[model samples]
Target chain A: MNYCSDCGATVSLKIPENDERMRFVCDTCGMIHYQNPKIVAGVLSVRGEQVLLCRRAIAPRYGLWTLPAGFMENGETTDQAAAREAHEEANATLRDLRLYTVISVPHVSHVHVIYRCELVSDDFAPGVESLETRLFHEHEIPWDELAFHTVRKTLECFFHDRKQGVFPVHNLAFTIALPT
Target chain B: MNYCSDCGATVSLKIPENDERMRFVCDTCGMIHYQNPKIVAGVLSVRGEQVLLCRRAIAPRYGLWTLPAGFMENGETTDQAAAREAHEEANATLRDLRLYTVISVPHVSHVHVIYRCELVSDDFAPGVESLETRLFHEHEIPWDELAFHTVRKTLECFFHDRKQGVFPVHNLAFTIALPT
Candidate 1:
């Protein structure tokens, strides 16, 4: 954001005449740049009573298990992103995929949208980004080793909903106290 | 990702002897880096027959109308993120927020998760990030001026579901071709 896209001039942070908060405004073109959070979508595909999970083969949290998920791309909707991730990571085709959860993690600059998908086929294998892939029954879930907090929370909610037979909708956030 | 986070040594993208894909592996610390897409969450708060919409005060699509939404935080669940965004952008408290849509926009690096929230209070003003805020009944919506394609699709789905009184439980992504 150092250089202005409009006029190629250096941008500076300043409060607008009518507003109190600071904004990155271009000195030459008067363009104000505003950055917003990105969206990530994925699917929690299930077969019978088992949930599908993928072990990462890449960085950030390599070797950790996660649902098949990815960032939304330009010109694509969130559901397409979820299905594409599932197809790419696990080689799974999902049907009747339902919206499961929407979690916002502002600090990390991401919002996670997870879906509950029914397994349409058992045909699956590790994609380019996966180290290993498999299914786990509820009791056999690797709760202690799940990769991301959002994935963990989605699983917890799924199990609870299954047990109660009443999927109570909720929107909540967990503030992670990162070590400074 | 080419340098080791632990020892600051050069890392290499190496294919495991037995595997097919390349992986970024640190020789000194044996750490592997894997990057994945992130999730985004937002809420569609409906009051009676009208829905809440906000004009963007930020760029990428500034001044266009959109749903109140943002990214998920580290420790929060999807539901939490949705509610938080609703409160922050609209100053509106929500109750019985239900999962509405999971859209994947892979080309843009995000998955958008939207929820249908019940507006608990009418007390609201423009948040720091919004240019303006207002409620629009179905017939009054500015369809052509909507900010994002995902937002437009979500609203369409909401109306479709409203008509049937039977919300389809599935993730759907529309591959939209935006004018460059």
Candidate 2:
């Protein structure tokens, strides 16, 4: 941060007392602007034998397929965020969402927590963020065209668990390769 | 935030294009400063029948008992944060940390991601944030004096699951009492 939000004073980067990391500290107010990773909550929703997927209308992966998910806003629980995202992206209401996969994407400073949700009904249409929304069976999933690794991992685990007749919570981490 | 970090200009709180919520958007540089919930990663470490606890030396709950946990820093995974918190709070190393409980405290804008860890060795001491560190058996736990509800929940789930012989990941949401 260039200036403190509290006092509008210029900020300096330094390690605070009893701290190991450097932070944007306001000289006047002594406010330490600490930046932490964000939580991205989403759901891998199901309807009959199909899984829900939304085609992105936004950039960074426009037209690519993904589950309905987005940034977890303040004052909302992770599951609440997931269900809201479902509505925002696909106009879908989720029910009985179980904690499924938690993935940490350190390089991007984001964590993905996906829930296995059941669609409340078949009434769903694409919201503004999605070009289109559809459901896919296991054989119809566009594996190579998926938007993110976390989504791929969650789907793979869901299918594997479904085949094995046990659905244990999966925790995984993904690190992007540093540019050489 | 008052001033934009990108251009040092005053930021206006407004809903950006297609965004549902208001964000601090810089008029000059067009930077949408979005804020999201953070993750607090910690471990419920065990050494045989005892679980580790650290008495806080910091404010907010000075001298109250808690697990070794803190905010998940940037560029590190949640597991790494848990491991680091273990070392930083209790001067202890951990291994075999399985993801146990995920609790979202939306009122505080934080999610607690806890793991069940094994103490690497018996050599332990308090770090700067902890006044004292000790292992507490189930009967000796300071239930009334715990620092946070998330810590209490994790410990309760651990003991309950231990008795049940089935350790499934628990997902819970805690709401702070709204001011009247």
Residue-wise C-alpha lDDT for candidate 1, range A29-143, written one tens digit per residue:
7877555555677988989999999999878799999999987554556667689889889899999866777666756767677778898877899998999899999999998
DockQ, every prediction: 0.19, 0.72
lDDT of 2 by residue, B1-180 (tens): 788866678889999997879999988889999889989999999999999999999988998999999999999988999999999999998899899999999988999999998998889999999999999899999999999999999999999999999889999999978999
Candidate 2 lDDT tens digits, A1-180: 688866678889999997989999988899999999989999999998899999999987999999999999999999999999999999998899999999999998889999998998989999999999999999999998899999999999999999998889999999889999
* Model 2 alpha-carbon drift over 4 Å, by segment: A27-29
Q: What CAPRI-style quality would you assign to candidate 1?
A: incorrect
Q: What is the overall TM-score of model 2 with all chains considered together?
A: 0.96
The segments of candidate 1 whose C-alpha lies over 4 angstroms from its true place after superposition are A17-21, A166-170, A178-180, B1-180
**Candidate 2 residue pairs in backbone clash:** none
Per-model TM-score of chain B: 0.85, 0.97
lDDT of 1 by residue, B27-126 (tens): 7777664444455679888888889999988887998999999865544567777788877777878898777776666566566778887887678778
lDDT of 2: 0.93
Worst 10 residues of 1 chain A by lDDT: A167-176
Which model scores highest in DockQ? 2
How much is the lDDT of residue A127 in candidate 1? 94
